[model samples]
Target: MNKKLTLSLDDQVIRKAKAYAKINNVSISQLVETYLGEVINDDEPKLTGVVAELAGIIPDQEYDKMEYLQNKFS
Candidate 1:
């Protein structure tokens, strides 16, 4: 089941959001709903547990060998 709701947004924000919606092949309303749902029902406790698992595992230390040259060239 779903319900309708209305809200106000700045014109520029709406315009950009619409473009984002189009690029992603979804309606503006859907994008808004997804964003709102994520924010309102955020699982902070679960996220903390995931972060805890990565305690000392520094991701991609191999990138340091390139001296971050990939960013400059690519």
Candidate 2:
């Protein structure tokens, strides 16, 4: 069974979220639920560890693009 919850956000944020949902063919509530679920999942940590180990095996320059994107987003 699923529980109902209420959340408040700025109008502009909601507009952007709704636009993304429409582009992805999903409801805003579904997108929020999926993101919350991802945040609470333990398997994601395991996958992250594996990916991080693999990433460490790559040369530093090979990851410069990823670092640049991360900095851009951050």
Candidate 3:
């Protein structure tokens, strides 16, 4: 289920958010929605366990997985 929302934000914040959303390939609405959902649900602290600690041990990455598999199988 989805609902439309209207928010009041500062000009600079809106501009920066738009720039970040564009770079991250998501809509500003999506970025805000994801953030709000995370905050409301309070999921961050669950990552304190050992397995969760390993999550950041690897640096973030973007990969073309399909291309890699195709080349490997070619």
Candidate 4:
């Protein structure tokens, strides 16, 4: 179920948020929803189903994740 939300924010903040949301390929509503969900959920990113399955594929080995990603992409 989705409900309508009305927020009052600074003009500059709204402008920046709109630009940020557009660049990230999501609606401002999604951005707000994600932010609010994280805050309400104590900032833990909980994954489930297919995402959890794929996330667990990598072995729990001592490795630099950023370096691995850089090497993989580069």
Point to the candidate with the largest TM-score. 1
Best by lDDT: 4
Model 4 ranges with Cα > 4 A deviation: 43-74
Q: Compared with the true structure, what per-residue lDDT tens digits does model 1 show for residues 1-74?
A: 88898889999999999899989999988998898888889877344576788866776555574766777788
Ranking by lDDT: 4, 3, 2, 1
Write the residue-wise lDDT of candidate 2 on 6-35 in tens digits.
Answer: 899999999999999999999988999898
The Cα local distance difference test for each model comes to: 0.81, 0.84, 0.85, 0.91
After superposition, the stretches of candidate 1 with alpha carbons farther than 4 Å from their true spots are: 45-74
My TM-score estimates for the predictions, one after another, are 0.58, 0.57, 0.56, 0.57
Model 2: lowest-lDDT 10 consecutive positions: 41-50
- Candidate 3, overall lDDT? 0.85
RMSD from true fold, candidate 3: 12.3
Candidate 4 residue-wise lDDT, 1-74, digit = tens: 99999999999999999999989999999999998888798857778799988996777888898999999999
Off by over 4 Å in 3: 43-74
The list of candidate 2 runs beyond 4 A from truth reads 42-74
